[model samples]
Target: MGLLPLFTSMLLFSWTTLNAALKITKVDLSIEPSAAVYRDTNVALRCKAEVLTFGTEALNRVYTIYKGDSVIYNKTTSSSEDLLYHLPQARVSNNGKYKCKISIMGEEKASEAATLTVEGMSTPILRFNKANITEGESVTATCLALGETGSLLFSFYDNSKEVENARVTSNELTFVPKGVGNHIIHCSYLVFVMPNSFKSQTSNTVTLTVEELSIEPVLKISPQDNVYEGDTVNITCSVSNVTKDYQAGELLLSQDTELLKSGKTSIHVNWTAHARTPMLTIKCRLYLRDVVKVVNKTISVSELFSVPTLKISALEVFQEDEISLTCRIAAKGIKKKSKVLTIHPKVPVSTPKIWVSGSAILGRKVEIFCLSDTGTPPITYTLWKANKQNQIAIVHEFNKAANFTIVINEPGRLNHYLCKASNGNRTPEQSDKLQTAVIEPMTEAYLMVVPDVDDISEGHTVILICSFLGTPPVTVRWLRDSDDLNPLKTTTTNINTTSYEFVVNKEHTDNYYCQAENRANSVESNKINLVVGMAMWKKLLIPGTIILVVSSLVMVGFILFTRSRRGKRERAAELSVKPASPKSDDSLTVTLTHDTEVYNAATDAASFCDDKEGRVTNGTRGSVASLPADISNRSSYSIPATV
Candidate 1:
């Protein structure tokens, strides 16, 4: 067992020494150029294996290269030699983890894996012409990829976000950014002819800053035109979109380059506009660190807010008068405007006027107008009779300058009308009452004189009344002896009668009559015959006295003659007788008759009938006692002479 143990120890010793000699002391993995290689370029990878000591014999050594977990190349080398893997031209597919393996003297050792990457082109560079610029200003950026032979796909990014891509090796882009911010600009490129394809490595970042500029100061004015004196005008100079923090600057209000007001904020300038400054050109100015903004405005001052003028077409107004009124206003900075108004003027106030258009006779339609002269328009008329409250007829019509017409169907006496007018602008107005009279129809006229006695005494005052009966208002005329009498002697007493008074005389003792005339007809009164003479007592007394005188004289003469005859007959008596027979031619006869008051003596002869020439002759006278028998048979009467 001891011998076996010794032999085993020797074998273990040789194995231990051999194991120590084959163990790798150092293993190194590297790539030529020590950095990333471009596409289609030659690249070499080296792996070195070192041991504690070298073996003299022809050592059995093998070298192997691995990419990731797969072997790419295998070879044999001595213990003192280094391993190299060459790629004639690197491709994009040659990128990955790389490792080397070595085996010598029947022992193997491995190295840790290293990484290699192949790109299509070199890294691009980004450059900006200006680091900071105002907004709306142009900026240029350049992208360059060195050692790039073919076309390159270059992409630009702002803030790690891709903005644009172009297929050019060297590119310059000019643009204006609207926003204001810190912009980081970088470029990435890919080689079109390289084996590897993808987004390339990014370039170095360049910052491009854009800021917003302040706007020009704008001048603002209130009450643009027609500005009055003692009015406040507001002016403001303001800047917009300021990029940096700024304080309120001086805002200037200037007129014709002379500063009127200046303040850090908006200002109100109270300016009195007069003839000196009828027109003004004002400016507003704002100031920054080294920048200024100015704005100008023009203003004109004139009259404003004036009272409107009133014009009337007429001063005096009557009924049915058309009137017009105009109101005109003239203002500054505005067009002139006017208003025209139409008016219907009213008449003066008084009682209502009433008139009948036609005759007011019975059974006739009469038109009555009740007019009120005071109201505006649209008068209503109503007709009524006396002692009645009810209306006869109503007229309602709208006429601004017309009267109301009321029609009566059958007009009668004591008819009254009333009128009312209202324009809805004032109180209702009324008119006075109107009464009507009866109308007369034409008729035949008749006239007469009073005191129908035909006798008129002289030197007597008599009233000759000429009375006429006809329609009222008959004219009376007096006529004497078929001639017109003077009007001074004729007096009218009433509408239908007249009177005349005069002293009766010889010239006035003529026939008088009256003629009455009207519109219908005319007629004359009956004639009155007047006689003027002496009194009846005086005329009869004179005639009676004359007749008495004549009768007395005759009686006295007869008596005296009788007395004288008696005296003469006593002195001488003589008788002469003539006897006559009955048949004889000459005879004396006598006859006597009874007494009568009146007697005629033309044929009487008798005896003892005393005649005026009786003579008594006794002796010679024959008695006439014998008469004719018939005459003697008559009654005999004694003759009483007498006294």
Candidate 2:
């Protein structure tokens, strides 16, 4: 039993040792061309494993390659050689973390991760079919990425703004730009690989210049000389520089706003000139898709003929007289035309009546009108002074009535003036003579005092005559000094002379003037002073009475002287005793009466009579009172009664 237990123990120990020795030891992963490389380059990944086994024969090995956490490659082989994962023409998909794991007989080992990088792409090249083109024309642009493989997206840019994008297999794109002026254009491409995409740098820039279209239309007119009415003209319109490179276009010809013709490149039309439309404007237009060109021209048209006149056959016409009128035109270097009108027994003018517009005043103009009730037009009128041969004025008028103006140089001569009317007749029609009453304005006036103003006396009749050289009816007024409102007398008469009579009195003594007024004017005569004197009878009686009174005083004084002488002797003794006392009878006192009437004279010589008589009377009274008593009484003195 002891020997059997020892044998089991030894067998158990050998089995344990065999099981421990059959485990995998190490794993390693590596890549060929491990540094960064460009896209589309070939790359290889290899995985290595170390195992501890007692057999000398090969074992079945399972290999797996991992990108990130997913298995990308797997293989089962019965060899110990290292395992490899090969990428042909590697792309962006081949650029990530890679790890290798090996499994042999239920034993597995994994390697540390390694990365594969693919870098860079080829730069694009940009090209254009045309660098300079017109605004409406297009340019073809091409983008090329040489030695590049993948699906690519091409983007085109003008300045910095993207214009177009295209996805294509071939590395080419066509681009068209907008607007005019200089443009900078470039292109870039994006390469699409399995899970990622790559972009290439922009290509070289190209400059493009765009310009405006230069196509101008032309217009022409036939018969280039002066154009006249009723003449036909041909007009043509065309354009230049219209080549086969552009699409078919249209051409139009027009006048003002009316279209005349339309065609492909040119057009022709015929038109007639008219007098109403003297000026014309022609226009030609060329039209393409979005472009137009235009041209314009102007023309003038002139007129053909002239105007007409008329004439008469005779200067005077009468009743039952034949007359003729002709219409003619004088066309220089052209056709002459004429027409005649005749009338047998033509109507004669009625007697023409004449009158004046206003009163014919001297030194002023007057208008006279003459009219015929029946007469043809184109009548001639003549004004005569004394007879038919003496013509004052002649007026030719187209109407039946005519007028004339004349100054009234002599109003009396106006009565013989007459007017005559004629219309191609042998004898003119005569009117009744004009009886023009003229108004002569007052020019001179005279105021005369009748009965000799110097001999005027009180209670005598005086006459004031107002005479003027003017036509009547004239108003005559008598004024004293400046008081004209209350005239002493007023009268209106047909004659130029008038008179006013008054009994001379003191109230009538003042400055007197007469105003004579006619229709034309009023005039004042020279002023005269009127005075009243004493009556002629009083002049004779005053001096005679004075003489008689002086004679009577002489007689009384002589009588008184005798009586006093006798009384003186008787009363001598009494007189000597009484010492000469004053007594009423002793001195003979006399009283004389004087005339106090005053007279106003017309002349200075007659004004001193009243004062001379007063002085003489005063001297006589003084002489009488101063004489001695006896001598005073003996003087012959007689006192006359107051006259």
Candidate 3:
């Protein structure tokens, strides 16, 4: 019985172990059409797996396909038959290394890699939208790569030079040709894939003829016959071919460079005839994009009256003299008549006078005046600068005077000015140059000493120089210690520098400055302190006296120190007393006495020693005896004598 149970347990364990061992083996991948095919061809990929399962129930199998390193398709099913993955309209992007994998339970297997290549693209066909083309017009071009797929780049060339490129699926582009000539055009395409791309051959060439615009402008005149002066004339300009098929452009009617009228299609103008010129040329212009068409016509104008003749009673006449004059005129088909009158002759204007008023300083406004004398009632005056062809200003006045206001910006620029006058005479008379001057404000003033202060000694000659930058006629003044009331020297000069020379002395050892003034402004120079040195002989005498006094003091100190050493030795053998110790509440008293007349000196020495050590406590008292007369008045303490 025990052996039967043991056998049953062993059988159960063996069956369980066999059911868990599910695996996949022998995986094969294949492509339907050949390994290499053209683009847009339908393709199929087959993945087959041989699975070994010991269980009664079916095991789930997973199928995965790869292109390069990316998974393209995956599926899970309970079937063991071969599976298929279809690619509709395969393109160049599908050309790469492909693989398949099968998985059952925990065990899987992969098949070897297979390569698919898509090659060969159709030659591109090129065509234009119209048979004939015109300048300034656009044309549509179509390019086709019949069997190609994926992204494509189409290029259009004109005479072997690329003009346009488009990346589109419809493959159509519009462009305009350059100039008026026959152009040879062709097109090509590029097939773009992930790992590889292919370019097709050029298309058949087509010749395109571009012609000029066919619109012509027409010009017409109303009075085609002999036209007379003071008559109104009409002009018309038109374009016959301006229709819906053409673009709208500008139309202009002009005489020479002057435009009389402007419109979209046609223009009209009314002008009065003049006898100044015998013949006049009128033009009509059609303006399109980068193209212009012109038409012109000429007309003649006749004079309506002849030139007048005048006769005077006297040839030589002065001002305020009366004279008789006769005026006559004759014309074709008109009567001639004469009229007598008495009038004064016209007088020409004299040369104009020019002057300036107001301050002529920089950055200030000033007025320039111009006047002409002994001229007609109305006269024209003009102002000009020397050597300049253009006039600065002009004015017409019955009083024969004019003025121009301007700000002066440059110094000494008023000399370049003149004026002219005219009253319908042969030529204008001019005035002389202007005589105005410009003043510039002082910017800086500097004062300097010829010999520096350090080098100056008694009886040395020193010079004080004042320099400045400003207009002429400047006043310079030298002051002592910045005191204007006590000026040492003052002068006016046209030059830039002025100076003063004097001998150095005790009175010269003081601060000095200078001031410069002009019509515009005044400025002061920097202050300078003068320190005169002593004479050489006096400097030597002062050191000699100091050395003699120091020698006498040294000898006295040596003699006194020797005597003090001897006295200290004698006092070393004298008896001394030691004081007793006291309690905290009791006071300690110390007395020092000297017997000589120098007792005040001993008291001073003891006080110095006490300061060096520390302050005495409140419970302690110190005293000196036998003070001197001067010392006793100040204090009573003195040192006592020792036996």
lDDT of 1 by residue, 488-532 (tens): 244334365567767766676667777766543567777777666
lDDT of 2 by residue, 428-514 (tens): 888888887888898888988988878888898999988888988899889999576799998999987889998987677788999
Candidate 1: deviation at residue 499, Å? 5.7
lDDT of 2: 0.73
**Shift in Å, residue 242, candidate 2:** 30
Model 3: pairs clashing at backbone N, Cα or C within 3 Å: 593-639, 593-640, 594-639, 594-640, 595-641, 624-638, 625-638, 625-639
* Each model's backbone clash number: 4, 15, 8
TM-score of each: 0.26, 0.32, 0.35
For candidate 1, the 10 contiguous residues with the lowest summed lDDT are: 624-633
Tens-digit lDDT string for candidate 3 (1-643):
6999989999988756754676665898998887788777888998988877775777778899998888989999987779999877776667788999987755789999989887666788989888578876778889977866667888888898988554445678887887788889888987766566778899988888889888888888989678987677999998877678777788899876777899888888788776657788889988777667889998888878755667888864446768776777765554434454445566777788888876587777778888877766456667776667434444444554677776778887688878788767459888888889998888889999989989888788989999999887999989987466868988999999999899987667888888999888889999888888876667787998788788878878988877766565445223222236544465433333445343344666466435543333555533222222333223223322221
**After superposing candidate 1, which stretches have Cα over 4 Å from the reference?**
1-351, 355-370, 376-414, 417-430, 439-466, 470-477, 494-503, 515-524, 531-534, 538-542, 545-643
The top-ranked prediction according to lDDT is 3
